[model samples]
Target: MWISRAGWSVLNMLQLIFTLAWTAGLIGVAFVVLLVTRQRRLPLRMAARCWVPGLLWGSGAKLVVRGVDRVDWTRPHVVVANHQSMMDICVLFRAIPVPLQFLLKQELSRLPLVGAYAKAMGMIFVERSSAREATKRMREAAQLVKAGATLCVFPEGTRSHDGEVLPFKSGAFQIALDSGADVVPVAIEGSGKVLSLGGLFRVRPGTITVTIGAPLRTVEIADRQLLAAQARESVVALKREAA
Candidate 1:
């Protein structure tokens, strides 16, 4: 199921281009419609419901999410997931059953249209160079969670090239701690295989499993490093289960 035939690579690239083109159009329209209607989060909900599912289907990726019952979807929580491929972004969007925003890299927020779209979606950008600024944004993210917004953070900071579950960074746990919200560890398996051409970022048509583990309580976790370690353990275990 994970194999990517060389013959299909070209088709995958073409499909990726086509799907992205149409998806971007849909997102742009969603934004405009929501802005005109004075709607909040409806655009993101629409993307999750219509655009994302279509994108995944177009890529021929069957997303199977396990442990859905573990999460209390009615409330806000910090979702800390291990990073892999670009497909992991789509997988998380589709897997998490809620209106979500991300803690995106500051660099990504510099992209022309992407930055605009992400900000419109209420996503927060992390400025890695300035610790003070980054912490300020994280506090803002914590406030968002307090206001009942679910946010996702890839604690690994970057994607893993060898599919290894990297040690999670501490920043994600800080959001949970600051917001007084639980930490949900998400393990995404097989995302790398679906985009197997590495930097090419084309879909190879495969199955991706997203495992949402039971929410880890952050009530007494004052140390971000400890919380990060605990979250990493949970993610690693879930990854093993899905694999």
Candidate 2:
């Protein structure tokens, strides 16, 4: 039987409440573990790998992952992906086997538990107000990646409202160049249908497919723009394959 609009609204509200509670509890436990161990990577990875998948499952969303074996697990990568929905984060966390750090806006650093966790886990925050500061942060992030930490970046800068891949920004590609790490393009599909921009509280049961493309070697690429465009094309191709 099809649910009425009002019934669907009620169900969405219940799911939202449960998701919030579940997130809080999981983060709380992870925070405590971090404090006790005084370790960042292991705790953060454990929390993310566990909580994110649980979040998706709690919202009645299934995940189909492809090309995960293409990733070279021995070395770090600058993983770039097209942004679609908030669920993209959960999907990436659940799909990627490596411990991944994010390049996030500085504003997110002000968020409560999430901010604290990000800080403790060595996630880089880009301060857009000052170019100097942002460059320094990016350099630090690149160094981290060089030292064997996989970094995930949404090079489109923001989520896509229309489920289309936006233009790729050069920052992520620059990081790959600076760190001499391979750029891994990832395509995320169907997340927008589950929970889209401006519809966070109206999540619907669905499946999200994540396709990880083979890494793009950036060592000889002098043009960041070209690298970004190439990466974007790879992601677009993967999206088509997923479709």
Candidate 3:
């Protein structure tokens, strides 16, 4: 016997609640470990490798990743991706093997435990309203990349409501150019079906395909906007390929 759409929605909501609880518990433990050891690497890695993947599994999302081997694990990269859903974060964390620091909105820095963990992990927070502050934060982020931390940024700045790749923001490209790091373009498809923007507690079991495009060379690119455009094009192409 098959379940009705309403029944399936109820089941999905229950699954999402369970996943959120499990993830919150893990983050709490990770925060404690960060405080005890004064070492953020292990806990951050655990979040990427374990917690994120667990969230996907618990939500019944099958992740298919391609071109992961193409990523140079030894060097820091400006990881740029088209944002679709909140699940895009989980997919990126699970697929990328190297340690990653997110370039998040400054508002996220105010959350209690989660914010504390993010700060400890050296995540870059930008106050977009202030141009000077944003530039300062971007410079700091570039330095972090130079210091061997891959910086992941959703250049779209917000989740796409219609699954279309939005125009790229220049901040991520600027960071890559300033740090002399390559820009790795990533395409995340099918996540919008799982948990789209404005869906809140709504989620569904589905497959997410992550396509990692070839790293764009920043050394030869003199224009940050051009680089951003190129990265967007790569993501758009990869999205088509995923389709």
Using TM-score as the measure, the top candidate is 2
lDDT by residue for model 1 over 118-188, one digit each (tens)?
Answer: 88888999889999999999999999999999999999999998999888888768889989999999999
**C-alpha local distance difference test of each model:** 0.86, 0.86, 0.87
Cα lDDT tens digits for candidate 3, 137-233:
9999999999888889999998888999999988778899999999999999999998766555677778999999899899788699999999999
Worst 10-residue lDDT window, candidate 2 = 196-205
How do the predictions measure up, each by TM-score? 0.93, 0.95, 0.93
lDDT of 3: 0.87
* Candidate 3 runs further than 4 Å off: none
lDDT at 183 for candidate 3?
A: 95
Using lDDT as the yardstick, the better of models 1 and 3 is: 3
Candidate 1 residue 40 C-alpha distance from true site, Å: 2.9
Residue pairs whose backbone atoms clash in candidate 2: none
